[model samples]
Target chain A: MQRATLNRMTPYAFMAPAAIVMVIALLYPLLYMVWGSFRDWNPAQTIGETEFVGFKNYITLFYDPAFRESLSVTLRFAVIVVSVEMVIGVGLALLLDRNIRGMSVLRTLFILPMMIAPVVVGLMWRYMYHPTVGTFNRWLKSIGLEGVDWLGQNALMSVIIADIWQWTPFIFILALAALQSLPRSALEAARIDGATPWQQIWHIKIPLMMPVLIVTCLLRLIDAFKVLEVILVMTEGGPGLSTEILALRISRTATEFRELGVAAAMSNYLLILLLILTAAMFAYTKIQEAREARIRAAAEEDM
Target chain B: MPTIRLDNLVKRYGAVEVLHGIDLSMEENEFTVLVGPSGCGKSTTLRMIAGLETVSDGEIYINDKPVSHLEPKERDLAMVFQDYALYPHMNVAKNMSFALRLERRPKAEIDQKVREVAEVLGLTPYLHRKPGELSGGQRQRVAMGRALTRDSATFLFDEPLSNLDAKLRGQMRAELALMRQRVHKNMIYVTHDQIEAMTLADRIVVMHGGYIQQQGTPEELFKRPVNKFVAGFLGTPPMNFLDADIVERDGTVWVTGKGFELALDGEHADAVRAHRAKQITVGIRPSDLSFDPDAANENSFELRVIVSEYIGAQSVLMCDCGGQQVVVELKSETPIPLGETLRFSVNPAGVHLFDKESENAI
Candidate 1:
């Protein structure tokens, strides 16, 4: 009995260090944030001195128009940037997945943008999108065209374009890897089955690549929701909250507005949203695995 | 059915040419099997015909129409890959109907054709299952069903049965032969297995080192191989070759080796009289060596038996003649003790002589 109990506890003993680290580094802060979300506490006062105000901060932020505007802006930015990046990235991968001279060098160059620091990417795009004295305006003037306001009137569009330019390579590299690992004989069989190049991609390649593309899209979506550095460096949420994503709002709420309790509440809300999205993805994979297991069982039974 | 013709087909990758110009033609409903060892350019030639590989030079014709530049889909051909190559995402029915669906055939017609082919292939019960859920033999049947549903003018198989187990390969080979009888199309198959080539091919094209060594009916190639490679490649207990010299002893042409001297008569005698090569190689099939205790010493070989491999009803004896190894097939019931020198008479008709320098049958 003692040996059996020790064997059962062996795995837990091995995982003890990681579990302790996760509790101290991750779960404690999450619990603290959730605990503080219901209080009317100021940053200057200790938590024991604060008054217990249940759900007031959460209720206040729920009806706040600026918070609602910031949330909408974040949702819009994430959806648009993620969709555009997915299309351009997967398209580039399909186009470049071949054996040609200098293809490795070309692929390396294509992924260079994703390697740069986010702040540097923001600075680089800010200069390029400058109204008068930058690359775009200079090129426009060279072509005898009047300069247009890039970051001022089109702040959201400028930030989105910058984010896409810096991040599309993330999807490109992954999609290219998935495309390369597909079965070569299946493609040949499709060719022999009278499928044109476009039909082959539509009927075989894309269906086979769906799982990878889905996971990549979800990862990019989660990253897009929490993006802050590039927009902070580029626009600082100016032009009336045009480029203010949820992460920026959370930062501004804590630091500038001096509402630590409200900020924690907002952080908890964002965490919940992310948790739901992650759970959905997990459920999808679980269902897929179950279906595959059932099919394998059927095959074994027949054999 | 279209008569497919390959006129001087060649394949080259950069400066290295793998397939020399190969010229061949297939009749309307003939089954042509290309048999060769690895790197013999058999697969390259098949891929060139299937348009999976580009032709470096030469022209391909289907019913007298040039199709060298056409894509695989445009050639009206269906291919069964060695791996079976069934689409994992599609069910058996959908896989069988893929070509018809791509051609925009009527849905009812596609369904009917798919059902007919699936029934014929004994895949009716698994029509709704994906390729991953089927056994290897079942997947192979689905691949064949897919090819049959296309009803293309030509079918190309690249070692389809090479991936199966020995027993399953035999079963599938028999099924393929039965299908060949029922489906009369221009079929070109490639394999390195000599037994498959002998069993299934209406015409066997033997290749070596990117060149056609010989091509003829299975019996013709087996009985009368043009060169040493084909002779040694296309037999089970391969033909035994011995270094010998042809000489005219007392107005009778004879081949004299280290431990045996065999007199040539009939066509071989006439050919030896006209031939000028003194040093030659004598080829004899293992089945042609018969034990004859009272045979003359000049017409018989005294070999020391080393090992006996008993394979069911027949047994093969590994013997040493002078210094060369020879294999002989005999009935397993023959009482022959090991480690004993025995006399085995050579059949006159089975004595094949080739020029030593050229290794070409004389």
Candidate 2:
């Protein structure tokens, strides 16, 4: 009886460290934020001294044009970035998925943007988009075109371009890995079946790659909704609220506006949205696994 | 149907060559099978003919037009791979009609063709299922069905039956033979099994070490093998060789070798007289030797029966002959004692003689 009890406790014992760390690092802050979202708290006041308010912060932010604009900007940014990245990344993968000289070096170069720290990426793009002296304006002026404002009138577009430049490598490496693992003989049979190169891509390559591409797109979408550092550095939600994405807005609400309740509520909304996305990805994979299991079961039953 | 020809075809990988200039002419509607051990360049030659491999040298002709430079699609050929290579995401009907759909054929016509071929292959019930949901045999049949639906002028099969179990392989082999009779297109098959070559081929091309050793009808190759390797390779319980010398024994040609002497038949005697080499190797199939204790001396061998292997009605008796091994096939009812010397006579017409050094039949 004692040994059986010990066996029952062993799994929990093994998981205890991770559980404790999650509580301290994740759950504690999350629970604290939920509690703080009900109280009109200030950074200067202790948590116990704050006067409790009921849903006023969330109700107020719902009608605020600035917050609504921030939400729309984030939605637009996430959709555009992920959609463009998927096409370009999968296109590059299909083009480079064959034997060529120095292909390894080229593939390595393609993924260099992904390995840099986010802060470093932000700083690098900030310098490259500097108004009077930047890569784009320099090249533009050199080509007999006048220098145009990069971070002033076109701040959202500039930040979006930077995010795409940095994050595209992430999707490229994943898509390339997916393309390489596909069965080769099937593709050859396609060639012999009178499938032109375009037809093979449309019918064979894309269908086989759909699963990985869907997951990759969701991962990028989730990351896009939370992006802050590059925009924070380059535009600072600036040029009259044209580039204030959700994460940047949430940070400014707590630190600059001293509205911890509204910030916590905003963070919760983002969390809920992300939870829905993650659940979707998980359910998709589960359905696929269940289908494959059914197929194998049917085959085994036939035998 | 178009006739296929490989004229001095070759394949090379960088500085190393795999196929040494293979030349073969496969007549229209003929089932030509290339049989060899692995790394013998048979599959390479077939792949080149299908335009999957770039021809390193010489020309491939289809109905007398050069096709070496053409693409696989342009050549109007279909291939069945060893792995079946069915599309995992597509249903059976979709896979069979993929070529027709790619060609933009009318939808009703495509459906009709797919249904007809699927019915022929007995895959009608699984038309809606993907390849991943099917068994290995079913996947192979789908691969076959896909090729059959195309009705291309030429069909290339690269070791298609090798992945199947023995029972299924035999069944599929018969189905393939029936399919061959129905389809009059030129079919080129590659396999390592000589039995498959002998059974299915209208013309068998035997390859070894990247070279074509011989090409002929199965009966012609079996009855008159040109060399030692061909003789030893084709038969089961392969031919046994014994060192011997040709001698003029009282005006009749006799071969004395390894604890026995045998007089040549009149037809072989004329060839033996024309040969300059005195030394020769005599080969005999195990089936050619019959247990006959009362036979005359010139046509029989004295052997020490060592062990008997009983396999149903016929038993194979491993025997000893003057320090070398010899095998004899006999009825299980033959009362042969172990460790005792006995006489097993060989059919005079079954005897084969080869030059000692060259290993070539004389």
Candidate 3:
């Protein structure tokens, strides 16, 4: 009996370090933020010295038009960026999934943007989007075309373009991997079954790749919501509140406005939105796995 | 149905050539089976006919029209893959009607056609189930059902039944033969099993090393093979080969080997006399040798039985004639004494001779 008990305890002993790390690093900070969101807290005092004001910060953010504007901007940016990136990424994957000379080198070049740091990407795009001395304006002037204001009036679009430029390769690499792993014999059978190239892609390839594509799309959506560094470096929320995303707004509320409780409340809202998305993603994968398991069981029973 | 012709077809991958010049003409509504070992280019030949592979140096003609440059869709051919290749996302009905749907046929027509094919394949009960939910045999039937709904000019099969279990393979082979009788279109099938070739093919084209060894009716190839490879490849238990020399003694020609001497008569004797080479390879099928006690030395072999495999109704006996191995198939109740010498007479008509140097039938 004692030997069996010791064997059972061995696995828990091995997992103790990770559990301790999770409680201190993750659970503690999360509880602290949730506690702070209900109080009138500031940077001048400790958490115990601040007075509790239930739902005041949340109520203020509910009616704040500036907060509402930032939320809408974040939503629009995420939706448009994810949709456009998915289309272009999957399109490029389909076009380039073939054997040719120097194809490996070309694929490596296509994914280079995804490997660079986000800060460097932001600085690089900022220089290229300069009004007069930028690459875009210089090329426009050389082609006898008028130069447009990039960062002054069109700051939101400029930041969105930069984010897309840095992130499209993430989707492209995944889509290409999915495309390459498709059944070769099935594609050959499609060709023999009188399907043209375009029909083959539309009917067979797209439907077969739907699972991987859905997961990739959800992951990109999640990342798009929390995006801050590139836009902060490029636009700095300038040209008024046009380019102020939720993450940028939350940071400004805590630092510039000196309202830590309101910032914590805003952070809770973002966290709630992300939690819903993460739950949806998790539920989708669980359902898919259950279906696959049922299918496997049915197949085995037939055998 | 349109007749397909491959005129001097060849396939090359970079610097290496896999298939040499191949010239074959398949008749309209004929079931031609390209049977060979793996890497023998049979599948490559079928893929070329299906327009899946590019023609390297020759022209493919369908009903006397050059079609090498045409796309697979334009060629109007349907194919069944070895793994069945059923779409995992689609149900049986959807998979069967994919071609018709792509062509934008009427919805009612597509539904009717799908129902008809599904009923014929006995897949009507599983019409709404995805391929992953079905058994291997059901998936195979769905693959065939998909091809049948196309109504193409030609049908290509690339080792369709090879992935099934042994018993299932036999059952599916019989079903394929039955289906072949009801639906007569230009069909080209590729497989490595000679039994499948013999049972289903109207004309069997045997290949070796990327070249066609022989093409003929089953009876013709079995009775008179053009080369030693065909003789050994097509039959069960395979043909036994022995080194021998032709000798003339007292106006009678006989092939004398290490432990046996067989007399040749009629055309065989004449062919042996006319041949310049004295040494040749003697070929004999296991079924041609029968256990006999009072046979002459010129017509029988004294073999030491080594192992006897008791299969119901028939038993295969492995024996040693001199130093070479010989397999004999006979009734299981033949009461043979294992570990002892037995005299088995050879049927004169079943004798085959090949040139030792070229391995060609003489």
Candidate 4:
């Protein structure tokens, strides 16, 4: 009896370290932020001294036009970037999934951008987008064309393009792996079934790759929502809040405005939005698994 | 239906040539099966005809039109892969209707075609089930249904029923033969199983070592095998070979070896008389040897029975004839005790001769 009891407790003992880390590292800060969001607190005051304000911070944020504009900017940035990146990434994968000389080397080079540090990518793009002396302006001037302000007029788009450039490679490698793992015989069958090249891609390749593509899109959206470093370095949320995404706004509220409670309230709002997305991704996978299970059950029932 | 012709077809991979110049012409609506051991270019030839592989050297003509450079879609052919390559995402109905839908046919017409073929293949009940949801036999039927839905001029099958269990394979093979009779398009099938070829083919192409060894009807290849390989490859218990020499005894030719001698008929007298080599190999099928207990026939041997394997109504007895292995297939009721020497008669028409050095039938 004692040995059986120990066997059952052995798994729990092994899991205790992870459970403690989760409580301290993840759950503690989340609980602290939730509590802080209900109080009218300054950064200088301790939690015990701060007085509870009862939804005042959330109410102020709802009425604040600057916060609303930042919210819209963040949503628009995530949508456009994810859509464009998925298309270009999957398209590049389909195009490059073949045997050729130096193909593995080429694939490695394509994914090199994703391996670079994000801050370095931001700095590299910042130099390229320089108005007077950068690569784009210099090339434009040498070609006898008028140089437009890359950072000033098109700051949001410039930041978006930079994010796509850095993150598109992540999607590319995954899409390539998915493409390579597709059954070779099915493609051969499709060829013999009278499907043209375009038809094969539209009907067979893309439809078969839909499951992986959906998961990839959701992950990119989640990453896009929390993006801060590159946009912060390139635009500094500048050019009159054109590129001030939600993460940047939250950071500025806590540091520059010295409003800890309001920043925590804003963070909660962003967290709620992200929770919906994460839930949708999980729900999609669960529904897929359930469908497969039901199918197997039905087959068994038939037998 | 278009007749298919492969004129000196060749396939090369960068440096190595897998298919050295293969030439074959198949008649319209004929079931031509390419049979060979592995790496013998049988599958490669079928894929080339299906337009899945590039013909590096010669041209393919369907109904006398050069089609080597045409795309598979343009050539209008459908293939059943070794692995039933059903669309795992789509249900059976959608899977079968994919080709028609791509052509943008009317919805009613597409539904009619899908229903017709589904019924024919007995896949109607599983029309709403995905490939992953179906059993192996059902998936095999779905593959056949997909091919039948296409009205292509030619059909290619790359060992379509090889994945099923033994009993299921036999059942599916029967169904395939029935379907072949119902839908008579130009069919090219590839397999290593000689039984599959002999049962279903209108013409059999025997391939070996990147070359075509022989091509004829199954009866022709079985009765008059061109060389030693075809003679040995086609039978169930397989042909037995013994080292022997042909010599003149009085006025007739006698095949003399370590075991016994057999008199050759008048028809093969000159063929053996003019042979350049002094030594030759003799071939005999297992079914040609009959157990004659009375022991009163010419060209009869005393076969020592060693082991008896009972297979239902028939039993096969393994025996030794003068230190060489010989097999006899007979009814199980004739019981001779083990270790008993019995007399077995030989049929002259079943005797085959080959040159020892060349391994070719004389």
Candidate 4 wrong stretches, greater than 4 Å: A1-16, A46-49, A282-303, B258-261, B296-298, B302-306, B321-324, B339-341
* C-alpha lDDT of candidate 4 relative to the true structure: 0.88
Interface RMSD of 2: 4.5
Residue B345 C-alpha lDDT in model 4: 79
Score residue A213 of candidate 3 by CA lDDT: 94
| Best-matching candidate per lDDT | 1
Clashing pairs in 4: none
Candidate 2 whole-model C-alpha lDDT, 0 to 1: 0.90
Clashing pairs in 3: none
Give candidate 1 regions above 4 Å deviation. Answer: A1-11, A46-51, A282-303
User: Residue A86 deviation, candidate 4, in Å?
Assistant: 0.9
Model 4, position B351: C-alpha lDDT score: 85
Residues A125-149, model 1: lDDT tens digits: 8899888788988999999998878
Q: Give model 4's docking category.
A: medium
Off by over 4 Å in 2: A1-25, A45-54, A281-303, B305-307, B335-341
**All candidates: TM-score:** 0.95, 0.92, 0.95, 0.93
True contacts kept of each: 0.72, 0.70, 0.72, 0.65
Give the deviation of candidate 1 from the true structure as CA RMSD.
Answer: 2.6
**Residues B95-134, model 1: lDDT tens digits:** 9999999999999999999878877888888877888888
Global lDDT of each model?
0.91, 0.90, 0.90, 0.88
In model 3, which regions exceed 4 Å deviation? A1-16, A280-303
Give me candidate 1's TM-score against the actual structure: 0.95
